[model samples]
Target: MNEIPAPVTSVGKTLLARIEDRSAVIGIVGMGYVGLPLAFAVTGAGFRSIGFDISPERVADLNAGRSYIKTIPANKIAEMRKGDGFRASADFTEIASVDAILICVPTPLTRHREPDMSYVVGTATSLQPHLRPGQLVALESTTYPGTTDEVLRPILEKDGLKSGTDLFIAYSPEREDPGNINFTTSTIPKVVGGDGPDALSLACALYGAITNRVVPVSSTATAEAVKLTENIFRSVNIALVNELKTIYRAMDVNVWEVIDAAKTKPFGYMPFYPGPGLGGHCIPIDPFYLTWKAREFDLRTRFIELAGEINTMAPYQVVERLIEALNRRQGKSLKGMPVLLMGVAYKKNVDDMRESPALKLFELLEARGALVDFHDPFVPQIPETREHPEFAGRTSVSLTTEALAGYAVALICTDHDDVDYEAVVRCVPLVIDTRNVTRDLQGTYDNIELA
Candidate 1:
């Protein structure tokens, strides 16, 4: 997983020695899904970790040993609070105290679907004044290539601490799958690249402590490209399957059945199911970063852009299917009808709702004069989002026979295992299943409709 590491310089040797001795203080900026778990993972590797965030609410919640994420329990936070092993703060002045700083901030897309690096830029600017010699700074945010060398190196080195000589800078993308039980921060392999050989050595040494394996690469741009490439692969494949789902449905063929049988080949086949739309922090948004950056080289990422268009149109297709179902089977119009939305979280059983398709479905249905209500066990109350601020403060409705029977149809956007789908099919007059979660009950329930 590593080529020959550069011979440690005097400053690099000192930090390397601290990393081996379990005395290194690790600072993780941004205390959201990626940062919170990563800080604890560093602590688990026997280093004291300081979590940084701009939100007072987040800082306060962490200080009080409260866990806002469902995957991370409160007991875990309380355990981290037993001593000075872990603590969170909003003060960027403390950046000078840490041996290494890992940036895990958000990199979202703007209204134009361009890379929005405000969080990363702001974090780098805040910590630049406090950056000291002999310290290491590694970015873990998923970004386009050249971000570490082009964006951060200048701002961090602005205070006269030269990279590789006075300090070190590197890029190591975060690969976090929110609800996957099979993997954790410590178990997943890390991919690291640096501005120079010295920066690579120091950053690899830092990450080696937290993860079981460390994959060292040549440059920061390469590492950044690695993350984008991974998500692009998924985005393209999901789009392919989604397009297939539509064509197969028109021919009265089941896309899920085809996938299930095709996967039995066990070679040259990987199954990626179609969903209402792409979701989470990565797949739906990351591909467009490459598309946007391609403009620099006068390149058009037509394939990736096409995939994005397909996925983006998926939510609208769901709305159309719902409308068609209501008009044809029930002889009723979609206007002024009650529709129950199941699973508002981006994925199954996760509390995160970043870029979820359910939000778009809500907007589209409501715009068509349909009354919409959602039920998600994980997300009890909808928080304010930049994209869908109108949904803020709305709470999840109850999922029961009595509650389900009131709605004209139940549309399943996320296939959360905790949901009683059998009961949903029985209680509702029509059920639109986008996830194929009701595959087993497809024939048993005549009311089920696939979107």
Candidate 2:
């Protein structure tokens, strides 16, 4: 192991002492899912934090002590504002005063399925002029390896501020599971990787204050690869079970029951449930970051490719099951059949609908001439999103026995906790459950069918 680089310059030493004393001013760029909670964490640790966002509306809401995310409450933001612990801004000039800056921007995939790093690159370009010596910059976005060193390093150093010597750079991927009650920003272990010793030391010191544990690795690329590996593991496991669902169904076996039995093993077993498809920011999108980068080495990520293919096709499979259930119950095709989709926010309890398979399933059902209406307690109206602009006017339908009875079939896509499964089984004539949400009502409802 190489010795950690000692802070040689006065600016570096001053910044390190401020971090130790909890007097460091922290700047969090991109105030979305990952950045908002992180800004709160840093401020809660007694550091003065500023949250930056490109959206003026988000900045205004944050400054007014209102929270857009469901998991984070307005009271928490109010608490941060009470003591002047945190403030939200759209000004890039504030970067000059901050001792450490953490970039938590989005990295989406292009229409061609390649890495679209425009947000990350644009942020770096905007912050380049305001960057000063001795400020530690860490990227928390999920992207391909070498993004920190290759993409951000040059942009920062373009104004003659060296990375390791004059300034510091690191990559620390965000592991935010929205609606997860178990772990939080402070409780989850953070992985820190740096370009060199100085960057590593600074990153560990900064993140060590916010999180319970900080796992330091050798280089920035290793840290990037760690995040991709975790998501790929999930993607591949989910794909396996999704494929198995079809096989077991053909054999007249319940896949959910098999998973319950297989999970009984005390060792070498971790259960990953099958769903309509993958959702959330990390699982559906992160694995492909590696797949795109692997092509540079003339190699292919077969597992990732296979997982993408299977997961991508899951929405179609769910629609097919719904159609089959409808035909069996009413002896009619999907044409003119009214179907109620239960839950549209991808997963339970969270309002995030990024890459949600439910939308795709809805589209397929609509194309087949099925009248589709959805009900999600978390989401009131479907917002106009980049990937799903066509669903803009759609609003959540009220769930009631009388209203549900009017539908031909109720398709369970998300299985949110707020939904009454018993009521749905009793009211709807035919029910297609993709999430095994009606497992408890298994032999009770004659019309219930698993997808």
What are the TM-scores, per candidate, against the unseen true structure? Answer: 0.99, 0.98
Clashes of each: 0, 0
**Alpha carbon deviation, residue 402, candidate 1 (Å):** 1.6
**Candidate 2 per-residue C-alpha lDDT over 168-196 given as tens digits, one digit per residue, 9 for 90 to 100:** 99999999989999999999999999888
Taking the tens digit of each residue's C-alpha lDDT, what string does model 1 give over 130-159?
998889999999999888888998999996
Worst 10 contiguous positions by lDDT, candidate 2:
1-10
Weakest 10 consecutive residues of candidate 1 by summed lDDT: 1-10
> What's the residue-level lDDT of 1 in candidate 2?
36
- Our model 1 lands, by Cα RMSD against the true structure, at 1.0
Candidate 1 wrongly placed segments (more than 4 Å)? none
